[model samples]
Target: MTQTASMSQNGARGLVRGGALDVLRFVAALFIVLYHVAERAPVSLFALHPALSRGYLGTDFFLMLSGYVLARTYGERVLSGGVGTGEFLKRRMLRIWPAHLVMLVVFVAFVLGTAAIGLAPQNPQWFQWSQLLPQVFLVQAWFVPGISGWNMPTWTLSALIVCYAGFPAAWRLTAKVRSPWTTLAVGVAIFLAVDYAALAATGIPGHQLPLRFGLVRGIPLFVLGMLVARMPTTIPSRLADGLAIAAGLGVFALQALGRFDHASLALLSLLIYAAGASGAKGSAWASLAGRLSFSLFLTNQLVAVVWFGAQRAAAARFGFDATMLWLTWALALPACVAGAWLFERLVDTPLQAWIKRWSRREAAVPAPASEPIAA
Candidate 1:
C-alpha cells in the first residue's frame, strides 16, 4: 500500500492515538521523575546507573512529541482555517492551565505552611516570592530571571505555551515546503545550527539551554517534530520496527556512555517517527499511562518537594539511620507516580470537563443584537 493508503487504512491510527508512542511518553515521564528524585536523594540513582543521570533528555523528547502530536491533530485544520489561531491557543491553554494553576497553588501552600511551622527548605532560593508572578502568568520561561523557581518543571510548560503560540506559523512553514525530504533536511539543519550556536555562545548544548531561555531550546525541537509529522511514512512496517528498536537502543547506549551528542536527540526523533509509522495500536494500559503522563510531569517536582522536606524534618528530629532514609528514597518514586494519578483524576479531569461545558454554554448563547447606529 502507498503511504497515504497505509495511513488511511490504519485510520491514521498511530497519529491519532493508541500507539507505542504513548508507552514511550509514560516512560519518559517516569524518567523525568527519576531525574528529579535523584537530584534530592541522599543516595543518587545516577551513581548506581549513570544513564539515569541523563533523564533530563526526557524533556527534549516531550517537546518534540508535543510538536508531532499537535501537528497531526490540528495542523491541517489550522492551515485551512478550520481552527482559528485564537481558538487553538485557547484550547491548548485550557488543557494545561488548570493543572498548572492548581500545582502552583499547592506549591505556594507548601511554602507558606513550611514557613509557618518554622521548617525552612534546604534551597530557599527555589521558592522565591518575587518569581511567583511570572510563574502565575505562565511567562516564567520567557527571558525571566529565576525561571527555575517555584515549580521548576513548569518551565517546560511555559516554553510549550510559547511554542503553541507559534505553532500555526510553524505548521504553515513546514507545509509550504513541497518536498518532504527538503523539509526534513531544512529542519535538521536548523536544529543543528541552533544546537551548535548554543554550544558556542554558552558552554551548554541547545537541548540543555538554561531554563530561563527554555523557549530557545524548545522551538527548534518542536519544529523538528512538525517537520517529521509532515514527512511521508514510506518505510515498510518491518523496517520501521527495526528502526524503532535501533533508535531506542541507540538512545539508551548514548545515555549509558555519558555522551550528550546530538545523535541521541536525533535517535529520539527517529524513535518517535518509527513508532508512528509502524502503526501499532497501543494497549489500554499504555493509553492510561499516556493520559497520566502530563500529570506525572507536572506533579513529580511537587512530590519531591514535599517528600524530601518531610524526610528532612523527620530525620533531623529522630536521627534516623541511613537505612530509613534509603527506604524512603525508594518509596519516593511510587509516591510521585501515585500523586500524579490522583491529581489527574481529581483536579485536571474535573476542571477540563467544566471548561468544556462552559465553552459549550458560551457558544450556545446567541450574541446580543447590535443597537441601531445613530444617523
Candidate 2:
C-alpha cells in the first residue's frame, strides 16, 4: 500500500487543539505579560530585572509567524479566487474587528471603572475627545497625537489594514509564478528592494526602514512568510539545523552579555525564522500558542491593565522590596492565563464566531486552473 498520510490540513484552519503553533503563540503572549509586569514592579526583585527581559522578541516572532500563517490560511483562497476584495475585507473584518470593538469598549469601561473606584491614577488630560474619535474609528494609527489612545492597544488592527490594503495587488502579482523559486524570488526582491530603496534614500536602510514603511513594516515580514509557504522546502534540514543552532546561540549569547541591539537583533530574527521553517512539527505547546496567540496578542494588554494595577496596589499595601518583582511575574502567569481564557470566552470567542458566521459561505472558490495558487 502507499505510505499512510500522517499530515493533513484536516480542513478549516479554525482553532485546532494540540498544536505547537498555538502553544508558541501562548508563550509569546505570556512573555509580553511578564515583560510588562517586570517593568512595572519594584527593582528590589532583582531576578525580574530588565536584563532578563526579551519580551519584545515576542512581537518579532509574531510578525514572522503572521506571514507564515496567513499564507497557509489564505494563500489558497487568494489563488483560488475565492477571496476577492469585498470578501477579503469582509473575512478579515470578521477575523479581527468584532473582538476588537468589544475589547475597545471593555478597555474604556475598565479605565472609567477604575477611576470611579479611585484605584487608577487620574490623568484627565489623557482623556480628550480629539484623541478618542480617531481610535474609535481605527484611524489613530495614522495620527501620532492619537497614539495616546485610551484603547491604544489596537496597533495590529491598523497595521493589518495597511497590509491587506495592498493584498489584491500582491495576490495578482504572485498569482503567475512559473515555479516556486520564481515566486520566492519575486517576493524576496520586493522585500529587499523596499528594504534597500529606503536605505539608499535615507543613507541607513534599517534605521530608515521604520520611517519609510511604518505600519507596512509587517508586510515584508508577512511576505517572507508567504514565500515560505510557496517554497515549502527551500532550505534543506541540515543547513537549516546549523543556521538554527548558530542563531539560537547568537541570541542567547548576546542576551546573556546584553550586547544585542537592532542590527544583531535583525540577524537573530532571520535565524529564528530559518530554524522555525526547518521541519517544524505541530507540537502540543506550539498548537496551544497558535490557538491563543491572536487572543494573547490582543488580550494581554487589556488584562494586564487590571492585573498590574492590582499588583501595584498590593505592593503598596505591603512593603514590597525589589525582590517582589520576580514574584509579581510569577503571579502574572496564572492571572493572565485565567484572564485570557475569560477574555476569549466572553469576548474574543463569541465575537470571532459571530464574524465567521456573518462571512460563512457554502463553498470555497478556487482560482482558475491557468493560475493555480502554486502553479
Query: By lDDT, who's the top model here?
Result: 1
Tens-place lDDT digits, model 2, residues 1-375: 011113224232222234334554566667666665565554523374444565555555566566655655566667677677666666666677777777777777877787797765434455565766666656555535433546444654666666666675676677677586787677667766766766777664522233213454456656665565554434565676677677657766776677454544455445645544455444555544555656666666666667767777787799677668567757766776776677776777777666556545533556578884522
Error of 1 at 325 (Å): 2.2
Residue-level lDDT of model 1, residues 139-241, one tens digit each, is: 8888897636888888888998988888888788777878878988998899989988999999888888988888889889888888888766667778888
Write down the lDDT that model 1 would get.
0.82
In candidate 2, position 162 carries an lDDT of 65
User: Candidate 2 deviates by what RMSD?
Assistant: 6.7
The models' CA-based lDDT, in order, is 0.82, 0.58
Where model 2 places Cα greater than 4 Å from the true spot, the runs are: 1-18, 44-55, 122-129, 143-146, 175-216, 234-250, 257-286, 321-326, 358-375
Alpha carbon lDDT at 288, candidate 1:
76
* Candidate 1 lowest-lDDT run of ten: 1-10
